[model samples]
Target: MSSRFLILFCGALVAFGISGCGAPHSPMTLALVTQPTRKNSLVKATSAKVSAAHQRIVRVEEVPNRVVTQSGLSVPRGFGVQLLAENLFVPRRMTFAPGATASQYDVFLSESKADRVSVLRVRKGRVVSKATFTREVSQPYGLAFWNNWLYVGNTDSVVRFPYRRGTVKAAGGAQRIAGLTKGGYNQHWTRNLLFDRSGKKLFVTVGSSCNSCEESSPQRAAISEMNPDGSARRVFASGFRNPVGLAWQPNTNNLWTVVNERDKLGDNVPPDYLTVVRQGAFYGWPYAYTDIERRIHADPNFGARRPDKVSETRVATVPVQAHSAALGVAFYPVQGGNFPKDYWGNAFLSFHGSWNRSEKTGYKVVRVHFQNGQPTRITDFVQGFLRRGRSWGRPVDVQIAPDGSMLFSDDSGGKIWRVFYIGK
Candidate 1:
């Protein structure tokens, strides 16, 4: 299609704004085939095609950051943490390109502070080259690829540019598709983007403007969807404070989000959360919250604004410890992954850490376990970012590489860490 016709076609589809093909990065598009449904919490390892070597046991180990922190980095015993690239200017979210192989892949990471996105070429688990994909962006944080175009969720808008698999640099200028509320209270300026399973809808996370107050715009404090070209915008879900990450479960295909809840009101009153997001569902943010035990309660200060909504707020599937600052979420592949079958369907999250708490919290990586397609619990996965209440590196985002290794970005250190299993 001609550029003009393609633009109009996309605009017609969205019914409001204009857009282009982009990545949803949704569940199993990379293909983690599931086993038969079972009542047990864990999926049965009955597939002969799955490698049994991944079943070997492993435990967390403490080590040093090697350069910056000088403090120990926590990782599993069998896995090694390799600093892929450093000196990046606030590297944030990341996405592996399509058509990647077990040994070679391309990761596009957004350096929000630098106002650019860069691509890292990895071969055999090591970074071979680094190059800029695009620049002159406004705090570009969220990234996705669909068909032949790449989408970026900037502070003020959702934009897209032509991108091809293995292409290190952008081929053309970006086309702004949808306008967004820019710069929320504090650090809510990061806009994360995701596409639904069928790529028919684009999900953009727009954070609330304040610590805990009624929002003035419909776009604030909500996840909204529109056509690929940015038309027919509508709120997908509401009442979330800061949902930094969005991932679809490989087995059950449910949309999961790790939220950063409101601060203040004491140390452990309300918890940050990992929850399954539903269409039209409202999660208590400025109004109320779902506790660690799965019980719902109204927000101490704002509950009276809408008592009905506060009382009716949906409960979180799993409540993380308060002030953890959950930022990114990545689900492990259930099939065709280098890790053992037991590691399949698990989700990894980045704790950007906390600032307001007197005693800081959440400066590490965590694993969210799933059984029978539902999240069972959250446990420490990678650590060492925090030592004696002082942190040198703050993890921002994480992604599973084509080789089944775990890669995370630490913005404070301006580095990326790759952890891969080496077997028992």
Candidate 2:
């Protein structure tokens, strides 16, 4: 469709101000006019063909010019995915209940639970689609498209769903890509997946099982890469207690991550950071933190004489304020279009926010500056999630839409916000 036609189509689909494409949102004005359904129907199991296929590396054409910008947008700032519009996806946290308003944005609380992932189509804040994650894939989290296959990372393992450009409901017999360390209170168990440029290497992040436990394999708190079929696994880097967000520099092929560090050292002792992941390099997790020398004067929680622990001795790339809880990272590539070249290789980080510190920190998105393939600036790009040290949204993962606009998720706020330039 022409650009003019596409804009009109979007506006028509969202005649009303709010629509739910699986993502959650505030109740609409119509909610007051109509009564909500008492109970929602359960999402039936998908066909065996969709759920049982064991295919790998399916071919997908280049992403559409305006690939769907939003999916499974949530509601209420921080609850569950909205069912309005053509809500194709659902939040891992919500389940519909009886008496749920049909106004698209009004979801009754009685049936709500955390969901894994939701699928939907969104653009310019409008939503389109009714197919949602409500029926397929178990607890989907990380969403990535490689060669037309949709790979979602969950708590325990990663699964693949076959999809085509402009296609919604995926062919669903999701294959288990890899198994992770089992349950633990401190285990940063959410597996977020990313693929390299050639689509050959798959990267999965497994956070530390605990705050600072002496893990036999430092990989416990690190990022790892392997084949999409779960073969030839190797630990990409170690030392991150919980490196939730992972992305590669668009041109250079260098990897980056945003780590949520351990807490309780002090109000502003150790800093949560975004840094370059070096292979076979340690990041000073339970033993050390953002600052190597300061660990000596910092909190003595684990004790002073654990002589075996390695010292940070050197500085790792550091970002914004301490305990800001930097989460997901995404690099906006330099496309051949009119978009500025300066933005081509910049990285955006979502600060999931922090609770352990007395003074509020994080809760916003920041951009990391790169020059000659090294981090030079970590500037704030989006803010206002935290108000007076309390958070309204917890920014998580960030992804670049097909149009080159940036999309990031806020689990705490239950919303996904998009960023783009309006000026020519």
Candidate 3:
């Protein structure tokens, strides 16, 4: 089973489980204010009325799974540990390198399982080369490129390695960055890493250890910043259940993030949000949530009495939809006079599909329309991740390649997809 078939088949299985529930949406015409119907559907990609503002929407033209491989650089020895491609793209398992200690990270290792973090060289919408770069760590996630180096975050720590751009192969093994607090369940253990535009500082996010419990200190479920070479570490902000994605605004260079809110609030009480992160701000997690005014509403679960030991930060800026599980954010810098000047400043984010919801949400990439440092609206850019009432792909992260094309990662399909705009 190739990656494509696996995605399609799993999508079909999910659809079969919920086919009799709803109807898809139809095409639309622009108006003064376009309102999207609150309903789930199984519609074709081109027919969806989701708008992209001035820019045209580019859908996925091709998605091939398990096509990525390793650098042929002789991974640690293991017998009967063949790289089975079909088992590679499943959603539940954590893919890791051969001979890697399972205890090092939370990877999917069974009689049938494959590794994550495969590499590929793509040009003109086709994969020219491929490799699977596995490391001796637990659940290698969150990849970022800065100054010819590739930084990846594992369950416990962040790893860095020298990378030659466009060469789809690892330059060498990884070096560890010190100072990260671990001890969380497997799901909340994901550590997302980001770099500032000037490369002066590195930002890392660690999710809350429990669903809605008071943390030991301020660092848990908060964003932290440090010097580029891993010095002068300090908590940037707190009160996020899971801040998975971080990006710098292209025009202002201000930091922003997409947070995954806590679950079990009657399925729709609190909404997941995207917000601008300030250096000393807090957005109220575990003790408060977003309200109509976007301020922190006192928590029905835990009252706001613990402000001394745990901070009760105010809730400010927030994005659309709750529990959307918005993960990866990528800013598209205007390149060589191709895109409009306004586009140079905007950002693109992938909501990697939602789980534990009454009705499924996210499963697509959205554009954050901003002006003077605030969002005007959140518009849909890519749809069809949730197909035929099921998710064919759950986008995890987005990155801008050296060539200016957008690279989107789907951990659900175990594949990385590329999208570029062409004049119609």
Candidate 4:
């Protein structure tokens, strides 16, 4: 650890009134501390006096008599997993066809490799039909439906096609809504589209161009907000390395995102996290990151450039396994859905797995439980992607079906899996 990081860690121990402020401790030592939600938690990513010590992962039940379980994969007790669709070419985010009810719905997904939108007709947990909704486009990654328009967020632009619930493919060309900065450091290339709760504005997440460097443009490393028709574009927040999944907390209306943090920090330096993405918040990309002790530390490499920026960097809320590559997030709706009542208002994340660790971690989905509009615990919902230290699939994003089941995409294996409750 750098001297500055150590000093910041020690200072937190003293500030929190914990005993043994001077004694040596394992870097991974964990102690739970209360994190009170702010009065207006939705307005900003509130600072946690302390951050990640250890992630709270509960018991993960192994399901029975399932194909995925053959490879040692598992889901929670009373829940069962079934294959929804197969043979997709690198599917990413998903959206249910509008005007559908119950388990009878068509899901639209983006095939990044195919560069087209495909719609799958699902009936009672199985995909009965698949067809190309639109084929002519760039690297399409995000899909959304609003006001009879199927909005597509390609790698380089936002476009829309005339869409109807039962129509598998559109009739004409797309209308370009917005053009985006094409590539970045790792060539992030994936552009995610999200509509705010009010349904009047749209938010687009654009990642920084490099691993950890000063960005050359404002649009890089920031989330852009604009009118739904692609007008009035402006930076909503900056300093995000790669914020992938965006969702809204129901009770508090707080915007949440799962960020894929920088790599090469050795095994577990700063854990990847899900936090409220407040407007104008600087999330310490090249300058700092909140550590296990809940204190934000300046990056030893770049903190010297802007000491003031490092000091004011907003603290992260819920911290997960470092390098877990948290990508897509979706919270169960509080009003309606097929999930059990206990699951309502909880958020689910797709951990796309990790490559920078000695022993690999995070190759499944997790349930992030919330209390008083704040995340409190994380528990595995699905697993076994990494068996014997080798992975077969990488979960990219998660979504809740209108009928109450959960759907997630695995790009590596080109498959979609659905989980549902089988018992009380």
Candidate 5:
């Protein structure tokens, strides 16, 4: 056997505590193999094996499915996961509408497949009543509440309806604010909407029509912005494969988004990412992928795309695992929050899981640790959505509840799950 393979084999055996080959499976054996050595190639090989073994150990230690919770999900100790609502038809995005009382809040959910936005009044931890807020929406995927108006993003246009504190139905006709590219039934047709902190501008995310092709419309593969009244429509940023979720940092005023990168680039070639959205920035889409190494491509349709585009691409704040299908991103606000103090300022992202890859990845929620308003690392916060290579739920969007708990939507299972810290 080659020395590299032998080293890995021996390391695995030692990691699993199996006695083997002339050398005893002891700490000394592990130290000898992993310690810095004179040979450069040997050192590289040994270091890789040791690192992988350490990662395996960490994964095993962190993800122990011994205890199943009320939601039939496995969560870390001191955390609680519960099904808040279920039996909905393809729930996508969720927002809190103003309630009648100070402590009460109405949760608005977009039932995408049903093309309607549903409302449920949740007081404390109980869902009081449920009703259809509006059935006038068409293939509604994103909903946002701003300044007494509820903006609904459909497949082709963004519309706004008058909203009151305690009302359920619209009193007036819907005003179409902006027109979006709705290429019939493509790979990414869902439109996500977000309003700026001041509610002066509304941002909408339009995904690329095809997986890896130059889109005919400039609006596709771009984040478009307009006045709250739906005027002054312009592409804010371009070249994103599928920018799904949009969130503004509480104090920083920085707009961030989780983008789903293109696929078919091997199992781990291109990584999906989260990054601050800069106006007019072009992220590499069909022509390039920005990762550890920038991969530039030449397309027959586009013909000799600019290589400089790769260098011009903004690097991701956090490069998530490829094919993970990162969908939702929401920052845990530090002020008046109910989560643990350590979770303050961190971002929670939902990986909608993988489809085309041979091995499944990302059927859970991950926390991106932040220090001084910048992302440091990613760690699994909620897992066990996948069991025995089968996934029971695919998390799509994540939002922070009024009480500081984390709320995420699972479209596959038609459920909304609430996760919160229960420890001191």
Candidate 6:
């Protein structure tokens, strides 16, 4: 055959092989037979890209001359602390809504005492406008946004309202989605809410009714989960005296929280902790406490009702200082912003500040270092919320801004403080 004809014949054979049109015995058929292997490898490569897209790699940068708040506090040398907004009515938890630009985001603050969700228009790291987003929220503590709906955790129930991007007010009235164990004068009343990455499951943390007592309600002292519309409510985990802060670790997708252990156990008996919360796992509240070594320490309240030794309880991942009242937990973004390179994958915790201990502890934010999705060390990131044997600000919740600044709410001082690294 002529050279041109041979070239066309070879091209036809290659196309037939790719399309699986060649005979089984033909040499060109081998390429078709192996196509599935190559296709599967391509699928795996695509999956790896998807996973990497979800994984964040945070690198530190620098910005200067932001509004510096006069709050007496100390952050790292290369960082600056400023009050983003002040005079918030007992703000507890914060959530952000989509904005027009990268620098413009609407921050929704749950005013626990004001019975409303307040909206703050943040433009380039400054509060431009503030207004009441919604009212009559019934002691809203936790705020989360999903699927154009804003979920608010009230003292007695979980409610949701319709929301739109860049809109200041909720579109409609609040709808009760789930009922929580509430009534009477309870010691721990705050119900913090968090949604899974898929937004399929909603997790709510209910504190114990009393200190170290057998809770009459099963949901008390436990983390509960349910559908987005409040169906199939079940206890995810139990035995925590007060699991206040809830966060999901990046990359691992593991649910982690910080718990406030029973008080009056002496100054340093049972330290507060940050731990990976497993499904249906108990952490030993009225019966016992899992120490740093994963050893079970029986609670004095249970006496013989609690065996001195028990199994099946998971220990804390990292034990914090006693009576620190660790209340809010937020993981640093995988794509680090202005913070240090070492801060990537670390968890920032807000210790609301202890009131029961002889000496004050935890009036600050702490950085829990993580290696391969597991905590390795805990370090103080923000301090000086307490000064001169008195505290003027008590941080209640923490959040990471879209621009990569660390923002925390201080209810005691009615202020929200932003901490960002000022690159050297």
Using lDDT, give the best candidate's number. Answer: 4
Q: Give candidate 5 misplaced runs (Cα > 4 Å).
A: 1-67, 99-103, 184-186, 292-303
Candidate 2 C-alpha lDDT tens digits along 1-424 = 2221101112312432225323332221111101111111111122212121211111111212221223332211211222222212323222221222222221111001244345444543345443443334444456666776767676677677665555445556567777766455454656677788888999888887777677876457878988988899989877677887777776765677778777655545456666667676666666545331112211244424442344432234543456776767877775642235776777777777767666666776666665656554344566556666666666666665555555566565555565654443
Each candidate: what lDDT?
0.76, 0.52, 0.55, 0.76, 0.73, 0.73
Q: Please provide, for model 5 over 1-424, each residue's C-alpha lDDT reduced to its tens digit, 9 standing for 90 to 100.
A: 2221112234433432434444553221111111211121111111111122212111111333335687677776778887888999999999888653425678899998898899977777677788998888888988988888999999889998898778877767688988888863235878999988788889999999887776789999999999999889899999888999999987887889998877655666467777788887777676555442112222222323554554455545556677888999999996667787778999999999999878888899987777777664456778889999999999999999888888999999998898877883
Listed in order, each prediction's TM-score against the native is 0.83, 0.68, 0.69, 0.85, 0.82, 0.81
- For model 3, how does the per-residue alpha-carbon lDDT over 269-309 read when each residue is reduced to its tens digit? 46677777877766767766653223334555564455322
Runs of candidate 6 with Cα error greater than 4 angstroms are 1-70, 99-101, 183-186, 292-294
- Candidate 4 — which residues are off by over 4 angstroms? 1-72
Please give, for residues 318-413, the per-residue lDDT of candidate 1 as tens digits. 666678888999999888776667779888888898888777878889877677776544557788788888899999898998888889999999
Clashes found in each candidate (C-alpha, N, C closer than 3 A): 17, 42, 12, 6, 0, 7
Q: Which stretches of model 3 miss by more than 4 angstroms?
A: 1-116, 146-148, 164-171, 183-186, 307-312, 334-342
**Who wins the TM-score comparison?**
4
Worst 10 residues of 5 by lDDT: 40-49
> Which wins on lDDT, candidate 2 or candidate 4?
4
Error of 3 at 357 (Å): 1.3
